[model samples]
Target: MAAPTAWIVAAAPLAAALSALAAAFVTGFDQRSAMPPDLAARFYGFFLDRYPLFAFAIPYGVARLLAVALAPGRSGALRRVIGAALGLGLLLGLSLHPTFGGMVLRAGFGTGSGAFLNGTPMAAAYAFGAAAAAGLFGSALGLGAALIGRPGTPRPGSRRRRAGRAILHALAGFLALWFAAALIGLAHDAGFGPWPRRPLDARDAAIAAGLLTAGALPHLLLVAARLRRATRAA
Candidate 1:
């Protein structure tokens, strides 16, 4: 059976954004907890972090989807331009958000009213920045993949294959790091871990690592799949 068109188009970006936000929120809430910890707070933090990624991915993914929907022999120049512009605009807009702008000003100049925001807002700002960075980077990568896998692109036997393999290998390494961090966090929570030597620190690291890994999985899978398809096409 054929897959739904919308799902096919949105799957990668949606997965990427959701996974990253999930990890960030889980970590943020875990760190902020006191006493018994608040599930509601955690959920709130998750949604807060999720909004930027979702917002950013929608336009970016839609642009890419439109590009892919074009005729196979058609030049992708316009699509590429649109994708880059949209990705950049989205990141720039997020960077300009008051909470994020304040955070950056505080970090870079150390001369802003960090008092402008606190707690979830502050966390969301950070999440927005991180998501933006990832989105931009992923967009660039998507462009590269599209170029390399273009309908009539040339394929240099070992070199092209080697490059593709290397990219996949790097992704695997990242996944391993994230998995290990998650395990470490789990162990610490269970009262049997080392390295971090502090419960809170371990928990934070684990949550972040696990979430990042999860977020990256979709991109890695998409790239790998593209490479396979390109190889076959060649």
Candidate 2:
């Protein structure tokens, strides 16, 4: 029982690392246009099309691996710190976007420069401060989760644990398949650049969906773990 469970636990991280590596490849393959607005459009397009979804999965996948890797040794303080840090990082990212430059939907060169450049020095300072705070917070959350969750070790299994593992493994498999399909779609090159098309290509849409699925994996894993534990204890 221990050996097999251990293998599953080990596999979780392997999966996450592989997924992260995949994300890097996807980002690299989808080159952004050179112009600032075009770049911004590509950046925003990545996020809008499906990148945000994929982004969340990454954190989720990494978190799951971390949970297994850090378990037993982890403490309560660490969990709190991690929660805090994630919360803060989220906050900082949001706050910085506005002050760094007023949120202009960047189009193309000379497309909307005025909107893009509408931040005062004071605004910049505030934005920077917010970013710093967020970083500190995210750091705290990571530390706290590490300490408290005792992340690496799998808890003793009962019927509930088994069921939970089954669900998670299923989820992981699904995500992996989804990612593979997305990669295929991306490879098709529905349209490399951000020039608007009358109708977005199917391959591009699939890629977007795949990216989102990747991003959401982390949160899904967290929830599954918690629920599994709860069911086991009950």
Candidate 3:
């Protein structure tokens, strides 16, 4: 890969890590007294364990590594497969817009965290449906971007073409981040029993969204780069 290409590859993980850190910062809250001790301990356990992994390591780091390995020289089929996964991740993220944004599970962005811990089936279904719908419009744009950015399709030298390709790559990375964020939700769902609640606010909500998006970017781009490399070779 050229210097520029290497930089492009390097940027995805950096962006993912930075976004996760920012989201973590925003979502940070001290509410030990707000909930039961056991429940609080469970929350902390997740925050310490799954939160870091899902937020930074698993989704972004692992997913990217997988993509690089899977999309080796001239592997269009594998690249396409990774692209599909990236798309699904993108859609998953779209659905969360309403959830933490005060549209789906909660009434508002900075409202109670109790809504997330509900063990009821109907609550889960309602939250799922709502988050899915919220992401609908954004998914269309993301899907379109994936199609437009099909690797090996764009030529190398034209400025306009390169710029357009760059934008598509950006969209792919963005959606990948969203996909990885599902882990953050899983962290909340851990220890499924209910407990006393407090305001979750926007910090955590954005972290939830961003971590998911960050995770998927590596897979999406690695596949694309592999496809492009293969195409050039052919």
Candidate 4:
């Protein structure tokens, strides 16, 4: 069931790109109705701009490429591509939800642009927070590998187990912060948080929270399952 060709890699990424673009278009259409047409267009354009993509592309591309590259069989690549497309779409859609200090990671957070992730502690908190959420987006590609097979040769030794468990816990905690970031957006949408920040309407925050949360469920469950399995094997 091994993939012997290189084109599969290109195909998977091409499909995911198309899906992500399509998702952006769909969300942009919704934004038109959600806000004034001009603002919606500005945000939509920003969503796809090179700057934001620049922030996310390097790490995400490396992770996604690895997932497709490692997929076992012909069908395994296809199955993972299906998940890749969906994951890419969900990540793009979630990025549209405005929050604070999220930087270009989720542009339109504290300011209109990314502004990198340095400077103030608030900005760094958001940078780390968004990276955490993006961590799930990056790593979740591995979950698609599961469709190809089950866990193999449990890495032997307590050290490996501890490290794996630690990584999972960190990702889980980061994802929780991602959710907390969403809540912060929700609060602002409800007219409570920092003033003059980029605004996400109540509907915007609610919808984004629900959709991103649903998207995160698989990553969360994957972590829980791994933890449980590791515990049992110990």
Top lDDT prediction, candidate number? 3
Best by TM-score: 4
Candidate 1 structure quality by residue, lDDT tens digits, 190-211 = 4332321223344544444454
For 1-234, candidate 2 gives per-residue lDDT tens digits of: 233343444345435644653554454533342447744553444333421222333344345435443443334655545654665454334322432211211111112233336553643433333333323323333343433453333456798977797567545544443343233223225343231222234454455445445533543454445535543444
lDDT of candidate 3 over 67-145, digit per residue (tens): 3333323346655566656654553344233322212222211122334545546545434533442244234334633
lDDT of 2: 0.40
- Model 3 misses residue 44 by how many Å? 21
Ten contiguous residues minimizing lDDT sum, candidate 1? 104-113
Count of clashes, each model: 0, 38, 17, 1
Candidate achieving higher TM-score, 2 or 3 = 3
Q: Mind sharing the TM-score for model 3?
A: 0.32
The per-model lDDT (C-alpha) reads 0.39, 0.40, 0.43, 0.41
State the displacement of the C-alpha of residue 116, model 2, in Å, after optimal TM-score superposition.
40
RMSD of every candidate to native, in Å, equals 16.4, 15.3, 13.3, 13.7
Q: Model 2, residue 69: displacement in angstroms? A: 19
Q: Candidate 4: which pairs clash? A: 104-114
